[model samples]
Target: MESAELRELLTPEGVALLDSLPPYTSSTDVLKIVAGLRKDGYSASLVATVLTQAKLRGKAVAKFGDFAQRMLFTEAGLEQATRLPVAALHAGRYVRAGLTSVADLGCGIGADALAFAGAGLQVHAVDADEVTAAITTYNLSPFPEARVSHGKAEDTDLSDVKSVYLDPARRTSGHTNTNRLANAEDYSPSLDFAFGLAEKLPTGIKLGPGFDRDLIPDTCEAQWISVNGDVVEVGLWFGPLKRDGITRAALVMNAEGLHELTAATDSTDAEVGELGLFLYEPDGAVIRARLIGDLARSIGAHMLDEHIAYMSSDVAVSTPFASTFEVVHEFALDVKVLAKELKSRGIGTLEIKKRGVDIDPAEFRKRLSLSGKNSATLFLTRLGERRVAILAQRL
Candidate 1:
């Protein structure tokens, strides 16, 4: 957001108006609210700012929960901010490690910094953007131990800090149209500088979940985290923050709670075996962390194909790391024949899953001519060189 818009939003009148506004429902609702405010003699700029904030708060619920209502956000800041539950986990690491003070470099809107302060740690939150820093200061106003600075992350003094948390800016400049920077060197503080800080002190560096595996340092612990089936971020822990003998880990969090799988070394791929009674699909975090073999061993399963992540087991087993499905039928992957078979079996609603193959599920679904009362999940994949289809029921 621009400075003038931010200044207006921070005014007492603006705060009162925003609080009085109802929760945003849709674009039409926003227009109606804006028009009503304008008709009530509120300035156009004030109405627009309040509407934007109302919209942002609605979107922020998934990340910050109820706390989002009191917080302000930029489009890009909210988009890249860490979820509150996940941020608590990050704070727990420092607390468990006996660190009391943290320097949160590149702290966007102070989301992670808020978590740190909430965990009772002193936080020095820094952001290069002026508007972002202002928002960060506002968001962190409740925590006296947390301070926001508008400056480059690399320029921040960390000599007195117990540890550091670096979340480099991974996108090019734009409020709502930001584009991701694919190269590590393109990050605001640069990966080299971030890694250097890690080498100097106990540090946690957050990067994209799909960060290059080869670029990871051998001395640090790399943990990939997923929330509600979506792989979110990979955190690299160095120095005192690194867990002993655990170089890689996968942490999955859902409504049930958080579960973690770790390995001291890279896990060897599970051996390929014939299709068994049940098929399993490992969580995305497991695949990203290369811990599929460990998960497979825990459930007495084998890989369905050497090159594929799908696993097969003779017995049905419940595991948090993977979703289990019972195999109902196996057939050669012929679209016309498969469509005929599905129709004959009275299968109508279908969920198509594919791996190690080239097929557009949506386009292919149109050709199936689906019509029935039954629902089934179909897996289109390769068994060695042969293309195959496995119809399964979710367990």
Candidate 2:
């Protein structure tokens, strides 16, 4: 959004109009609301701003929950903003470490800053973009101890700050149609500068979960976080922020709350063994943290293949680190034979899951001419050099 439009949106009259609008549901609903506002003599800019914010607020509910109603967001900012619950965890670290102040560099829309301030720490939130900085200032206005500045993160003053939080800009420059930058060097302020800051002071660097592991510093503690089964980001904690004896960690947050698995170093691969009666699929966070071996060992499971992440065990053991499945059938990978077998067993609906194979599940399903009364899951993968298919029921 343009600076002028944002300025208008923040006005009392505009905010009241935005608040008066019904919850945004679809494009047709938005169009009808816009038409009515225009008919009521609202300016074009005000109408556009209200509509944009209404739609953005609806989308923001997933990240900010009820607080989204009072927040403003840019499309890119909303996409990059950390979820409120996850940000609270980051803030809790600083609180536990006894850090009194933090500098949040590249603080998009001030989501993290708000969390830190709510935790009673002084926050210096900075964003290089004018609109983002303005929005951040507004978002943080309620906190007496928090401040916002429009400046480059690398150039921000940190002499008095007790610790730092860096979330580098990983998206291409644009107000729309932005793409993610896959290379670390492409990040604003650069990974090199960010790592240097971490080495000098207590710092937390938020990076994509798929970041290149080869470049991670040996002195830092890396934590992979997954929320509701999706691996979201990998956080590199440095100096005092790095917990004692913890070098690698996987933090899983689901409906049951947070569960963490930590190791002093990366776990070695579990020994490969024959397929057992049960299959275990390690959580994405566990796999990214390189703690799959630790998880396998905990459940007395062995790898199905040395190269693959799937695990197997004869006993039925329940664990939160992996999704367990009961094996029902196993056979050579032949589509015709599999289809005939499934048809005879009255299995119609299939959930095809594959790894170590090149077949597209949807296309393969279409070719099967499936028809039956039941449903089952099919796992097509290679057992060493031979192709195999395993039918299983999710536990």
In terms of lDDT, which candidate is strongest?
A: 1
Q: What is candidate 2's TM-score against the reference?
A: 0.96
Model 2 spans with C-alpha error above 4 angstroms = 26-28
lDDT of 2 at 11: 85
Clashing pairs in 1: none
Q: TM-score for each prediction? A: 0.97, 0.96
lDDT of 2 by residue, 1-395 (tens): 88899888888998899899877766547667778999999999999988888888899999999999888888889988999999999999899988999999999899999999999999999988999999999889889679899999989999989999999999997555789997889999799899999878899999899999998899989999999889989999998889999999999999887899999999999989999999998899999999999999999999988778889999978877888989999979899988888888888898988888889999889877889888888999989998999999888
Model 1 Cα lDDT, one tens digit per residue, 178-245: 99998888998988999898878899999999999999999999999999999999999998788999
lDDT of 1 at 274: 92
| Clashing pairs for predicted structure model 2, backbone only | none
Give the count of colliding residue pairs in each prediction: 0, 0
